[model samples]
Target: MFDIVKQWKWYDWAMLLLRMVACISLILTFIELRDQFTLALWVVVLWELAAFSVPWLCLLLNHKAYWVTETVISGGISIYLTSIFPAAYLSFIVPAFLMAANSSGIAYRWTGPVTIVLIPLLIKLYAPSTNLILMMVHVALAFAFGFAFHLLMVNHRQNEIIRTQNTVLEQYLSQVERVTLLEERERLSKELHDTMGHTYTAVIMGLESLRSTAADAAAQHKLSDLLELTRTSLDEIRGYLHELDSPQEQLPLVQSLRQAAEEFGRNAGVKVGLRVLGDEYQISRQAKMTFYRCLQESLTNSVRHGHATRMDVLLQFELQQTRLEIQDNGRGTARIQEGFGLSAMKERASRLQGQVSIHSDSEEGTVVTCSLPRALKPADDVIKLMLVDNEPFVRDSLGMILESERDFEVVGRAEHGLDAVNMCEELQPHLILMDLEMPVMDGITATQSIKQRWPSIKVVILTTFEQKGKAVQAMRSGADGYLLKTMEPRELAEHIRIVIRGGTLMDPSISAKLFEGDASDFLEEKTVIAPLDTSAPESSPLRVLYDLTPREMEILQHLSKGMRYKSIAMKLYLSDGTVRNYASALYAKMGVRNREEAIEAANKAGLI
Candidate 1:
């Protein structure tokens, strides 16, 4: 529909012009006849009729295409008729409607020029016996009228173009903004899934395994092991939550300020020039993250709104407060209006009892300055270093990292094999984050040796792998905690604290892996059996799954039948509540949840 209009709309305006001219010609033809011979007038009228009728017929067929030709023919007919037969003007019927239809707007801009030429012909025919001043007066007015209509049309077109351009630009920006928001959301979800979600699953699996087992040597051992894992995980979770809430870190103002500037550089399209001047004293983590976030907001505003290509960060850590300024050369309108992000930045600064000022302009770009008062802090404590990797780069990097931290003394170091063993024995600091893979003295070995010799000391196994087997081995070997190597320095610091405090740690993914396969034979493994033709695969803990009391077996059968918790509860004539307890026991004993897992376990073990 729109395509058709685009192709044919011009003819509409042309058709209107033609109709106006036809009407004018009809009037002039009649007027010319009024004063003179009816025969000449009749001839002019016939000409007008031919000119008007033919185009209108053409318009009726495809008015949009031939309207220009129609209008030109009609206008030409009107002008010629008036010029050739002046008596036609006496009728004056067409001028009234033509004037109204064309007006002085866009449609009439050309009409004025046409009128100038046509009126002259009409006046010449009618006023061949009149004064010369009257003709001059009429001619001058016609030219002036034509120019007025032309100006109106020009202004209207300019306005229309401006509006269309503005609409297109707005739509483009909106689409871009929507895409960016979706991308950011996707990134956040992936981060949560990859990091925190996996950790939680591992920890849950270890716990559930412990909870599901009967009180035997293996069950007791798994319970003790899982309890330890959960504690360390709790500490890490606390620290993560701490990061979420307070987000404060123990770092000097200068280091974190530089980090803020670098963050902007990383996220921004252009290079962000960060210059640090003066000594940066240690500040609280809350203050550091706040300053970092504030800097981030400023950079986002500069890059996203101001369109900055370069940004600058200047800092002066005085005796009291830290003064930092970030400036960008970008585009901004002349206004003091603040966007939502800027308002949030202001709120954070206010919470810190800090002051922030922002300035922006279309030409001058944007600047954000902030000054935060340092917290009344505690004195430094002893620095404890724990390296968990056998890689030289990793251990050395960690050692160098610790050594670089003021007051962080690398009291102990470990390489491959018994070097760690020797280190553990001699320089037994407050804690040791042992790695899983070492040459002769792997993290497991080092942990076992350390625990045996110095049971009072703590150890956290740091490694890249989080397999179920490895995790269970480390826990059984008396390792105090486990952490991914990808943790930030702040996270590592918190892990050390929780380890010293007798907390357990485990990522959640490990839990999902635990309930993955049959664990009946988990206590006594290493069996090689041929495949059995069954619908479901086999499960371990074969004895426990089968040795249910007859009534319990009946309940298990009901469970395997996909019965709801409540329905199963009522089926055995026992109280629904006791049946619920029986179901919980079923889940633990079977090492499964929901009907499918129970069915698989029962079918594999031949109990159902």
Candidate 2:
């Protein structure tokens, strides 16, 4: 597969020049033979033609047979020419030395040189006029020169390859360093948002409350000034957070960008239109933020630099990658330049294994394109779901609704809990939506059995009842989530997605039921069964407070206002399952089974 032309070096050129000189000298010797022309002379000319043609053919082909044939033919020609006119033997030197130098090993290196040297000896037997001493000197000098050139080329080629490899290695190291820095920046941003951000928010809220209660104008003025300073600091922190986290407060990427685009249009007096070309999906959190930043930067650049009156943002989703194009109908620049905005966009794309291209024309406006490669494994890409309900209509309805989703596959439908468990074993779906009440075996039992066998499979209790007791039992039996059948399709899908991502989801109504004062039986039984589960002194009334973290206390207060898990999660910038875990911990510390019991217990302990 190696091309002689491509691999040709200076040595090859030098050898070709020597070859041309030798060929010219041989042609002059042929002219000398033409002066004494005869029929035998014509046959000798033809013989020379056959001998000379094979060597050039070997050089072109570089094949083993050609090399072997050229060696034999050239050696024979060298002997014949030496017997007739010794000067013409110089023509064989080029081809003879080339064969020796081009050969692969030291064993084959002497073949052509030996052939050239022995030609004079072979000619001496036929004609004593052969000059053996001159022939040896010529052959020795040519072999030495050709072999030296070959060695030099081998060294140069190796060095070239090494230099190219070094450049690639340096680029790889730089990319690794950049990715590490990005990951570290993300870690710090999340830590700041979760811990310091929440703390600052509390301080601001407390300052507002303090200002409301200020007795004097002087104190109120001082409080107002302090509030303003804190607010500015919070804003600065949020700006940093936004730079690192991109979408900072939003969950879904496209919806957040749509809102942001609208707000930008209103503030900047630009018309912005957003369009999505395919079904929306849950991308990695980092990639989602990358897309948001790309969009935000494009819009900002359009407003500030392009003076764009109208802009269009398009996000096209495909199976392997997502493409984003942001075009602005502005007074475009003649040429695109990389400033902070474009540089940042490129960096973001690099982090996601994507590329960004900017095309600007003074006449046609500017278009910024970003392409990101996505590696979506089967588990993360789609959810295989099973539906279990006693009612045939209910099962069919849920199945159809879930199946309608592009990313959700309804694997099976079951009429009862036992049937659901049997079908689950065969299908091994990613998630199952089951009803609590069934004829043969309840949803709770089915969930318990299925979870016992295949613990990786997530089961959500989808029942009409908002009973706190059943919810607790289902959770204890390894159900990952609980939801009322009255939920909307979108909400249901979101919940399913949350579960598939290794998060838990429970209906807010169940949270409501846990906080109400109706679960006295469950509370009494928990107190009798395990009184020391609460991490507090027996005499202390507010026992739950000792077990709760500050963040947990904040979440509990939100729950006290009857906020759902999703709302609490959003308000605090936490995941739905994180809120659920905190609530579960709160429930455990209060010796309660559900939200109502926990809230009633908290109220009794004066902890709320």
Candidate 3:
């Protein structure tokens, strides 16, 4: 019995349940017809069987084709049964309503109302003794029951669609979050490497410098062993720092540090006050770096060594520099002892040509103050850069090199192409120094996306891979320049400035890759002009002129007239990047490095 019922679907079970209810009404009808007997009574019995069995069998067979047929058959038989037996109207009413509810859209819409209206009228005609109002009430109740079920089914389907959409949205957000997290971890690890590596290197150098001043042979031997031990320990510490940096973990930075401070207060059961002054963007990268290191060292010392119940962190930006002070009201020592943390902080300050001062006494708690001179802002004509690299060390080293110069600002750093695009949206950097191979999204696709979204922004493909195919692809994807990572820092910086000033650059190493066949050999065989040699004449006249398109020359003419990129783009019906690209091509043809040089060379050549 259980196995047989298990095969029944929900709709089949509904048909069975309806049949069960009909049984009770059919039995009552039979009692009412017991005394009255005639040939009509036998006809009534056959009609009753058709009304009860036809729709149920149709449902059991799982045939939608029979829905209209069953509705017609059930309605006719129900009316006939009611004619001979007035109380039997309910028996037909139940099956007729069920059939109509299960019918197709057009059939069900008309059939259900028609069935309800017909039941009352048929009862009045077949059995005049039956009260019309009483039969109509029963028909109305049955229709309402079926209509309620329809509404429930419609709502269920809508909910299913919503759930499906929500699932898709959740998956998309998860992927974005995972990618963002990984990029952030890469940035933090790189910061750790720069900070700790500098500290350790300083300590090692200080020890080495003191080795010659050892008092005796025994002391000199001990110094040698101590220097070796420090070197070995530094290597192990580097390995540990690498392990601690994982994408799944979140590290506290100055931007989202409120939450970190709150957590620290809650867990440590202490009151911590943090105050930041001035806009983070206005603070130079060098200043921000020094401040962060000082903050980390001071916070740890206060909570661990001082056992402070209350601490305050304050940062203030002045005209020439920023001052950060960390103070804690804890047990004060009579004399201040310079530990590794304090020494490291002093060393970091010195590197930036800044000052560090410490004050402590028995009555007053320790106060650590660090003053750092703000890095000079890049020139009004400077290039704002975003660096994209998978390697943390590369990002750090390149970023520092750019920040060290007065003509460049490293506005943002990303470990992957996707992060680079996202950060660019926020930072609005003028140029992006992109690496080809990265996680999550690669340079080629990201360059395309960025160009499509923000055509004004420039992209330079900087990578270690020296592939001809990639160089061409990068250019096709809207990259403004392509350079090998092997280029020296000064040379790379110069190339970036050239690109920023409406010139395109291809590292001399990869320039041969741009052409096909013997062009590579021809390029190699060509005489290399030394741009940096002072002994050579500043302007050397050559017989052959560079090949430039008419359009490129027109753009160069505009540049020589002192037109900005946007104005030139509008006049020429081109995008800003496109105008820059044309101007860059003109620069190459003129054998000049930037717009100014190109114009100067062109003036001498009488070309522009």
Candidate 1 lDDT, 38-124, residue by residue in tens: 346666566666655665455445533333543455445544544545443332223323332334336445544445455545456
Task: Count backbone clashes in candidate 1.
Answer: 38
Better of 2 and 3 by lDDT: 2
lDDT of 2 at 214: 89
Clashes of each: 38, 7, 0
Q: Write the per-residue lDDT of candidate 3 for residues 1-608, one digit (tens) a residue.
A: 35456655565577577766775566466557656744465565665566566656655555463565455666666566667777767765566656545654555666666667765686688789787887777877776676666555556657855764454345335434643564466567566655665566567666766786778888889889988987787777667666755422323235534444554555455677888776543443334555655765665566565666687876666555667777888776768788876786788777565656765567567777787655434434466889999998688777755664545788899999999889978998888999999999999999999989997788999998887777767877888888988886667866775565445677766765544447543333221221222222334333123545456667867888999989998987544544655565566667788888987887776555
lDDT top scorer: 2
Off by over 4 Å in 2: 1-4, 24-28, 35-66, 107-109, 205-227, 242-285, 288-608
Q: Model 3: residues >4 Å from true position, as ranges?
A: 1-12, 19-70, 96-112, 122-131, 149-183, 190-237, 245-508, 511-608
**Each prediction's Cα RMSD?**
23.4, 23.0, 25.9
Instruction: Note the Cα lDDT for every prediction shown.
Output: 0.58, 0.70, 0.66
Better of 1 and 2 by TM-score: 2
Highest-scoring model, TM-score: 2
lDDT of 2 at 348: 77
RMSD of 2: 23.0
> Lowest lDDT 10-mer window, candidate 2?
525-534
